[model samples]
Target: MIGLVLAAGAGRRLRPYTDTLPKALVPVDPAGEGTTTVLDLTLGNFAEVGLKDAAIVVGYRSEAVVERQAALEKKYGVKLHLVHNDKAEEWNNAYSLWCARDVIAEGVILANGDTVHPVSVERSLLDARGNGQQIILALDTVKTLADEEMKVVADPAKGVRRITKLMDPAAASGEYIGVTLIEPTAAAPLADALKATYERDPQLYYEDGYQELVDRGFQVDTAAIGTVSWVEIDNHDDLNRAREIACQY
Candidate 1:
């Protein structure tokens, strides 16, 4: 499976830092003797898991990635394919993902570009492969649930029951860490589901597309990544936390 990163969001919350750069390009840590952005860590994780190629959905500040593409490829030893999303600033990630419909058939391990987590999270997803699992997610069952988290509820005997960011924190089973393994067979259906999702509401997130899949009888499973230090950088505070935890990896 190839690595896929949804890096198109214009994280307006990260003001000056995001003025000319996308959220994925926001510097968060100093690793390997260089100031590494969130995208660097994500691509590094993919390489650690033996995924030699990755497609990153870019927009908002697409030229920044284009300028650094060769260096990023050389650093991670992973070929970079930039997937441009024309509507990244106008629409949400549900539409951004639909922009990558062509590469879905390659069976991708999708990671949100803004999340800073260890390679263990990706390893957990890869380890849970087979057994007919079509859509597998990396879940943080150990994290303290909060309103801002992208939460989930699941059935142990079945699979994910629901996924949304607007749910009651008390009712959630865990938080989705924005990493997913989409099996080859599930690609076309997922693409169609994503299309229907964005068409229904252009502002919806890609997680909403997973909800659409579940609503249509698709089984979306989860892999618990026990305890891990991970953060989704949306603002200055999150960037601070990311720097603290990312160095541990």
Candidate 2:
């Protein structure tokens, strides 16, 4: 499966630190706890999952991102595919997804560059592929989920049916982790929906397009990922938690 790393966010909250570089380029050490850098760990984790052919969707100081990724590819010996999104600063994660639409034609795994997730989660997502299922978003039922984290409402029984998207912090039952698996068939529909939304409202997030697919009849499964070590680092607190968790590996 192809691995698509969304490494384009500007990380506005990260301020001065991010003023010079993308958040994904921030250091994260798996062995030393938040000491290494997120970009290294993210790429290394993908390699550990048996993913060799990987793509990184970059924007917002993409030059730095490209240089870093190139160095990583050489050091790790993993094939790296670079795709650029000029409007990364204007759009959401969905725009990054759109940039990689053509390059990825089969089953692929999607991950955010600024997050550290359990290695097993990536494997489970790739294993959950089936017919007519274009995307399988990894989710876990946590006691407290922040508003910044992506949340979703899923069916109680099937565990595969996703009812709706939840961005409001107060009205959420589960938090979506950083990674998702997508099949080739679901790309075009998602892309088309996104284009329509972009034309209508350029500020819409990528989830809007996913919701559009759901509204137009698409089966995007929600794979339950319970009790996993998944953390998305966007601020100092998240970085602290990432450091604590990284040491456990």
Candidate 3:
């Protein structure tokens, strides 16, 4: 199985901080002598999960990010491949993910570059492979769901039956922890659906493609990661909070 780190976004919410540097390179905790960048932390976590071969989809000052990650590969002996997204700003994360579609096989873990989580996504990947499911998104029921965060709606069985299109500040109950374990065999069909949707309605969110599969009776299960700490850097406020979490470990 291969691990894909999606770091191609322009990070509009992060503003001036991401103006010069990619969000993955932003230092999460600087108080300690051995402070690590979000990218480094993610790599460390992936290493812990026993995922040594990885690829990063980069954009928005990709040269700098590539250089830093190259040094990391040399220092850690991890295979870090960089795939550039030339039009990252025009597209959403799903499109960025498509940039690396050729490399990702049937058993692959798709992770957001700006995320750090306590749980190893390796187990989720294993579960998906063993089950031979089309898709399995790692979900955590947050105590408080914020207005701007991505939310999920599951069935009474606690499975993610639908990813809601309605974006309301009051309708959310669960938050996605930036880890989506995808089956490579489902990639072709899923990507085809996404292409059709994107061509017809460019404004539609990427998850709409997944929902289409769900609506068609494809088994897109929700694997719950109970009591795990995870953070996705969206803005400066999130950065500060992630810094606190980083210091705890």
* Local distance difference test scores for all models: 0.90, 0.73, 0.70
lDDT of 3 at 6: 78
lDDT of 2: 0.73
* Steric clash pairs (candidate 2): 27-37, 28-36, 28-37, 29-36
Pick by lDDT: which candidate is best? 1
lDDT of 3 by residue, 1-249 (tens): 667787777676887767876777777875623347777777776676677778889988787676687678865556888988876767666566666777566456777878877645546545545655566777776546666667787774535666753666366547677777777787777777666656666555567767766766666767767666678887888888888888765
What tens digits encode model 1's per-residue C-alpha lDDT throughout 128-244? Answer: 987899999899999989889999998877899999989998999899999999988998989999999999999999899999999999999999998888999888889889888
Instruction: List the RMSD of every prediction in angstroms.
Output: 1.5, 2.8, 2.8
Residue 120 CA error for candidate 1 (Å)? Answer: 0.1
Better TM-score candidate (1, 2): 1
Mark the 10 consecutive residues where model 3 has the least summed lDDT: 119-128
Off by over 4 Å in 1: 30-34
Off by over 4 Å in 3: 32-35, 121-129, 156-159, 165-173, 201-205
Model 3, TM vs. native: 0.86
Residue 196 lDDT in model 1?
Answer: 96
Number of clashing pairs per prediction, in order = 0, 4, 1
Across 166-213, the per-residue lDDT of candidate 2 in tens digits comes to 456566657777677878777788788777766667776666666677
